[model samples]
Target: MTTQTKVSICLPTCNRPDLIVECIESCLAQTHTNIEILIGDDSKDDRTQRMIATRYQHEPRIRYVRNTPSLGQARNVSSLFNRASGGRILLIHDDDYLAVDGVERLVSLWQRHPDLDVAFANQYEVDQAGHVDREASDRLNADFYRTKSAEGLQQPPGRTGLIQMFPNNGWMANADLVRRISYKEQYGMCCDYVFGVELCLAAKQVYYLNEYVSFYRKTDVSISMTTKRSTSAASVSAYAFIEKLRLDRPLEPARKLALRRIVPIVVSVYSRNHDPIKGLRIAAKNLFAYNYGFSMRLYYHLMMISRSMLTLKPR
Candidate 1:
């Protein structure tokens, strides 16, 4: 008596011909039949295209697209939505493949809880050869998908709230929710983090599935772990979001205290990975804006102090 909910699995891949087939195959093999797979591949090499044409040419539900160069990940992802034709959308990265029954489980859960804006499942980490690694639990943070409301999301301002809320890997969102809240165009690596945070903050209900529905490939050369600007973009964007939050919402002293602790860590992680100059600049800007006040300023100063200490210390 219920209408079948359609799913659009959006994959934004870069030059992973070897991985592409498996990723698509896993999605195609979903226990849920009412699903469409959309690929927004930006591979400089055409191996992925060749593979799709030769091996996957028979699939009707699969659509593959080649993104023009230099569009970047966030923009490429935006384009994926345009190609989507399902009631719900799942943004699956190229290097990640879903579980055999992942889509079916998600659909069953969503049907039971239509009020939830976002739903995330557990994922495994594997090496290039597809050997699973149990120790790479860091790749899978299940807590982020924990049930949270907009009101309960407020915490004594710091990483505690952010980490507690966004402690996971891939997520499924209501297509309508995404269309209503735009992704920060400039966000590269951290776009997922920023997007997840924004969506969660605005969502009335969120769900966590404590089951591994995907395998996140853990290679030393993966873009996420690399020192690319995309990797550090989330920090800059989060600070920007904090400023917006400060203007839009008023929080208690506890929340403000948490913010103070969070800003420094943001800068510290940014500086260590990407541009120290940009990190310092953001810290100074936020501090002068009095976003979190003197304690946060002190925290950034402490990070610098520690760096200096390490520099001056004998190795």
Candidate 2:
């Protein structure tokens, strides 16, 4: 790639006009001059389009697309990739903003490793008011394997991504790799992770730059925030996709046990979503994964019964 390689910042938004403004500004503030910002507004109303028109109308670097009838979370993301004109694409969620030199640093890393298929870095988590949560950020980084000790190319990208979720904010990837990939509608809320895994496997060249390159806004509506209800089926389906994937022989067991070892908190949620028969079957299937003794299994059934009864009753 040339020193002046172009980058497309794909910012996908919905009705959150208030949040997206900072995202656009952050893209505009990138130190890399050869770039374009593509905003696919999936908002049901014209609020987002109006905001861009008024605030960034004169900005030639931005190309805004108001998706008709709203393309939904997964498709909206894919649409931005479809329109990207740069040799590389960096995706910045509407609710998140880049660190001023995010693009410059990631671009520099890619330039250094010209064959890099995907590259991503750490982020600082901030609340609605933009106050950084120092503790939560540290936990998140540790949870995702974003250790302060290591940075640079990953030897086996898929394994690193499965454990660390490298498709997160502050990511930049070859336009060709991303263009060949799409956020499958079937993946639903977990489409991004699924997409990232696909890129990791196909590319065979991925990098992890362990530096904070962006701010992840922790808004109430952001999916990271727990909701009043659980979408167990969606979560199950995405996990199924992961389970079915064929990776290098050594990585398969680690991949299967990855979610099991980490997401034990979801046991009750999964139980509540299924009928008693299915719930018990699930419990039996992953008894070892849960690592819960007989007492825990009994407790799971009781909780499932209570929640199931509650949901069956009319409001």
Best by lDDT: 2
For candidate 1, the per-residue lDDT at 51 reads 85
Candidate 1 lDDT: 0.65
TM-score of model 1 relative to the true fold? 0.74
Q: Give the count of colliding residue pairs in each prediction.
A: 11, 0
List lDDT for all candidates, in order: 0.65, 0.76
**What clash pairs does model 2 have?**
none
- Tens-digit lDDT track for model 2 on 1-315? 444899999998877888888888889887777899999988889988888899888999999999888888788888899999999999999989999998988888866887788888888989997888989987777777778665767767777666645745569999988989878887776677788777787776888888888998877776644532464334555556765777888777558666664333345555556444455555566665666545665576667756775676455
Candidate 1 lDDT, tens digit per residue, 1-315?
112888888888888888778888899898888888888878898888888888878889888888767357777777887778887888787777888888877667766776766776667778888888775643344333233232222232233234434432456778887656545576656676666666666777666666667787777666555643343545555555555554233333423443454566566665555455655665666573345455655566557745744555354
The regions of model 2 sitting more than 4 angstroms off are 1-3, 223-228, 232-234, 261-266, 292-315
Candidate 1: regions farther than 4 A off: 1-3, 142-161, 164-169, 228-233, 246-265, 269-315
